[model samples]
Target chain A: MGFGGRCFRVQWGPSALRRFRRSGCRTVRLSTVRDSTPGQRRVPRPVDDGDVPSVVALSEGRRHNGRVANQSGGVTHMTLTAVGVDRPGIVAALAAVLEDLGCNLEDSTMSILRGHFAVLLIVAVPDTIGAETVEAALAPAAHRLDLTVAVRPLGELPSLTSNDQTGRSRTVGGAGADLGEGEVYVFSVHGADRPGIVERATRSLLEAGGNILDLSTRLVGPPDAPVYVLHLTVGFPPGSDAAGAADTVRATLGEVGVQVHAEPVEIDVL
Target chain B: MPVRPVLTLPAPVLTCRARPVGSIDDEARALAVDLIDTMKVSPGCVGLAAPQIGVGLRAFVVDVTGHRKAQSCHGTFVLFDPVVDSASDLQPAREGCMSVPDLTGDVRRASQVVVSGIDPQGVRRTLHVDAFEARAVLHEIDHLDGLVFLDRVAGPHAVFPRKVYR
Candidate 1:
């Protein structure tokens, strides 16, 4: 399988499933979106303290066991989510803690909603570091920042397509890959503020064989007839109907928008 | 010039408005060659601003030739103390930077623009460009101004993490 983004790998077995791995080039590539504050990474430094361990450790342990150790090293992946009232330096503060613990910050996203800052991070930590130790390590920063944080060892990776009815959806709902694979597109819907827009619009994209990698919405315009603007980055399987998917989504969102537009995100890696 | 290391986020130099290149001195010429060599060696890299290499100066190199999204390829070129003479037709597109490393954002940029500057040969040139070339030029210019794509993202949700599988 190509490391193209949004390419779907259909699993044939007792239970049918699909996985989303993204890459735009010849090599099998993987990319996760990191939503964080900019320029906070220390001056041109080694990305991981010269350490070379990965989530590959999880492959041998499999599910039903949260603590998996790689024979070469004891590093494994953990999922951490945090949220609290919005404030500056929260990322830097947390980044410092992770660095001190020798944890590698993997995929992540941080966004301010209303007055709250929410972050979902996947980190690789030494297997010796349990969930509680991580929570305790972050306790000081969490308290100082007035944030609520949770860390847990990841079990089996959930199928990328089962968001509607799975725990994976709750933990990392919008933490999907950026569509650099097969075909990438942006589908946006804007109109008077209302409910069910996300549910309805995202449903259509999912139905069109598109994986919703990232999604965000904003309430804009005057207080009266405020506008709700939503943008989605979608990755479709190779050679799939990208334009058709957008048309299907636009048609599905039908007039729920003052304006609805979809276009290919033709990105040149250069 | 050797391929200098790219300075990443939070590097103080990246946010500082670079000094203007008064004239293409030997140092300026070397910086141009370094920028060109660095941009050439990096895969999927189309441009590089002086600040990206930790040089607080107004210089950048861009080469959009052979890119599928490019409409007005400039081949490979460098400009010193460049300035945008005119810019219009703003559109939002996802952008990633070598300095930022781990994220991408939907940045609004002028799809068409007129830019003037001094070439490495110390000769003055004005470029009228559109489409992907315009975007690449604007991106490098922002770096010269000490601004990364994060500073120009559309809104709160326009930023995304760039996941890398090693």
Candidate 2:
């Protein structure tokens, strides 16, 4: 199928000549200054000495090496992966440690795979806290659970800027390579895990004008069964018949003894 | 003309709906010029509204085409008494406001739009735009309605800390 219709070219207007001054955008509510009531003092209030104790400061402060300070909002994001022999309280123990550090768990996904419990979390903590503090504070818990842990700050949030007036709707790639005419399509293929199963499957898709948007695969079942579960997102040519693409993909994988299931994504309006 | 101080959130005038353009005469043209001059004089600004300069009039200026990604759009316009046609689907975009300093947010808006309004010369015209142009036009239209970007933020994550966006 040929890519026809409009190529979606960009358009320009007189505003093109003017320089974009980044005037910050925000709104404010009006606050009417209320006059003080008669006989009401306007002097600053002072804290009572007895109510505020200045005698002793508690807790020792330590200089953590390689601490990246997150001074923005109170929200924090952390990705943690843990693997350990089946044992109770592994999560509880680790969670307790994080809670003690004043971290709030936002969201988490956990699964038992290959006899190991893996957990990923989006977390939040008080501002001015550093990644080092979280790692150090969680180190003891990791050791106790007998699971290795890795920690890093969350990736920067994406922002849409008007500096470029070309509102070309774009989908970004994790590998930083722009996939041509990308669209999100999900695929699942089940077959015996072999050296070239994934390679052949992806190759077939690429030849049919599809780009793999996201992919994850795993060897499943016992060694005797030797089955595999492959999950991936592929971009199809805008003009390609989506059903035909799916069928072609399935047929190509079938030749290699792989079972494939593919479907177009139904994107909800934002 | 002096660079007018941008009124921030909590400024009563920001939410106060502006009056329609009575006539696109010298004073209205002067407001447009002051807006352009004031915006240029400020550090980094893309648009300005009369309400931001303490005028409650349905007039604003925007020029996003000079910025990145917006190069394909109509760069600027002195939109007066504008109305956005809602004939297209809404798309969400991250937006910042000059009045509400230090905040940015994701705002749902029409992906394409046609704006009808009187120009400084009292001539009525309709401008068609899509995507970023639609977004910029919608943003300025909000100003005419006495609305701010903060009002469009869906949630906390929808808003971001201000960066030195030139």
Candidate 3:
């Protein structure tokens, strides 16, 4: 069916751009601030005295591990990792600290795993700022929230050029570029957990000239015989045989004892 | 009638329930013409509601004669005070709206529908539509009741950012 024509493509104007900005698309991902009533006072909760020791121990452990490295080159990229007991305001506090340090958050994923809130973020800072400076700046908030924070300097970003025999070019800094001029599809694979499933499936797709845009995997079921589920959003270059590439990916992944399915992510315009 | 600009979200007229066109007067017929004109000028626009063009009246135009998904082909037609006589076979499909640009959402709508309404020629007509034509009719009907696809999405995650089309 010609579903493409049914999807509405917005014609942008000045007013539309203003509405897009006011939509709060940026802050909606990680954190949302609630407006308080005019005269309402929010009382701060008292920090547990016993939590201080563990916070100090965790911070010391991170420092001793030597994970914080100094890069002498003009490195502007850094990865920040933080973990603490799940609570409100952790993201807000960390964001405040980063803002004070003049760091721009590029990409981040925050989630609660086994009752602990973890944040892993890629940030861009001035060339003069080192990983140690970020770690030092986060020390106060980390201690206040009983979080273990670490920062590691990243290597040079990959230039926007085709790196392999395939004509696909890698997006700079891996910030997940828009799938320009491509056919987007969702690839789903699920089966009993085993080693090399991701490698084998992705390798076959890559060979078929499919570029993985976003990927997420989960392991569930009993630990003895865990089931793995992998979902990937991939893009095939325009004019490429998307159906043939999907069949190849499915067949390749099927050989690894998994059920694979691929479908076009269709959008309808009104 | 000149083709009017299609209004987007947060436009109060789009959300307010459109008043019924009790009589097919010159103004109501003019609205029908404007709806069709606007839909024709907007490439790929299969349907348009009166409120989308700031009319705030119960009327819409739909055409799916050549669409690939269209099974029950209906040439361009305008309806005033459309009432869905019957609808069945609910199915979920992703749809975008000119009024809610930059996003698409999954909406469960009936695959088969029978509707009766007053045509611009001052005649009563009923249509039995299925597949894409039915979907288009239901979408335009929503505007008459002050509802959009955003209100019908399955959940928050059901909405997705749409790529801009040149």
Candidate 4:
């Protein structure tokens, strides 16, 4: 009777087979309506006035859609990336061309990689010149240098200012709290390839509520006698009455058979 | 008027040989104050030579105490007609100038130095310094010798495009 009751949920009666075959015989189109709201959508307004608002707004929207725009000023942010054999006056020639376009050089990082000079620039100009004009202006320099030039309109500029004005505090990388006024200790430990050394020291410091600011570990020594070195700068809570925090860490690490050097860093800058 | 503007690059004054101070008088003291004021506003400046401020005198003001590398350092200094008594082996460091607003270069300098000079009151003094302090002193002294940071750069690779330092 129990087995019969369990089999009742399967609907293995003749009606179940007939319903499945009938459903397969019919055509059904499963379509979905995406919610594309008006306010959420943006329309591209090219630089007519060449003001920052229009240029930034348009370029920024483009960036969110996975595009890079260099438009700044009223004009679009101009960008040129070139890689050519290193020579004198390459930068000079490029700078002069940008200056002629009435373009304001915002930021540029140029370096010689191997035997070639690679340049990346963020330039701005008044909106009076359109994308075509900018392309034409840089063409001569690109030709003279025998370099490739790629131009594009920039999307809006992202807000770079810290957003911690509200009550919520912001931390870099969003994992730990920001550094507070307290004693900072820099600890270095080296031991033969072993387990439980890092774990033991970290657990000891964590129990004492010490915050690690920056930690770096590297492996040295021969493969047969591998050495692991851990260097860490840690922060302690303010007025925690822990004068020998570094020593305490060193002692815990010593039991793990690692040589440790713990010194109080001058925390005046923090 | 207020302190005179410091001469920037291509101004010609920055390359002129600085005249040695015969004595520290009111004029010299006023020039020192001008140098201090000029250094304070020269963006990422830590020192100013008289030649840079357009006075072309062998005097300079250094307050590297405010710099990140010079955070732990002796207080400010006002040296008139400074001369190095001795110097250690050369150590090269990257340096930027207010005159050369958008240029930086690696310049060779003494790792440690002892400088003899006069204060604003004409009182003679000597200082023994090491590391970045010595580098700052050497940079300002180069102005006295009619040398700029560009002149000390070994090659184009030693120079850098300047960026605004926070």
Question: What are the chain B TM-scores of all models?
Answer: 0.96, 0.88, 0.97, 0.90
Query: Comparing to the true complex, what docking class would candidate 4 get?
Result: incorrect
DockQ of each: 0.07, 0.06, 0.14, 0.04
Cα lDDT tens digits for candidate 3, B5-89 = 7776556677678899988989888888888887887756789899888888899999987887889977999999999999999
lDDT of 2 by residue, B21-103 (tens): 87788899988888777666554456678888788999988776555545337666787898876538787666656564434
User: lDDT order of candidates, best first?
Assistant: 3, 1, 4, 2
Candidate 2 chain A: 10-residue stretch with minimal lDDT: A8-17
Better model by TM-score: candidate 2 vs candidate 4: 4
The lDDT, on a scale of 0 to 1, for candidate 2 is 0.57
lDDT of 4 at B142: 87
Per-residue lDDT for A1-270 in model 2, tens only? 122221110011111111111111111111111111211222221222352222211111111122211223554666555566644555555555565665544334455555666666554555556777787888887887687776678865233232212221111111111122335467989987767778877887787777775566788789888888898777665576656777877898888788999865532111
**Fnat for the candidates in order:** 0.11, 0.00, 0.21, 0.00
The count of residue-pair clashes in candidate 4 stands at 13
> Cα miss at A96, model 1 (Å)?
8.6
Q: How well does candidate 4 reproduce the true complex, by DockQ?
A: 0.04
Q: For model 3, what is the alpha-carbon lDDT of residue A259? A: 91
| Top-down TM-score ranking | 3, 1, 4, 2
Residues A176-230 of candidate 4: C-alpha lDDT, one tens digit per residue = 1222346656688999869887788787787777877656677888999999999
Worst 10 residues of 4 chain A by lDDT: A4-13
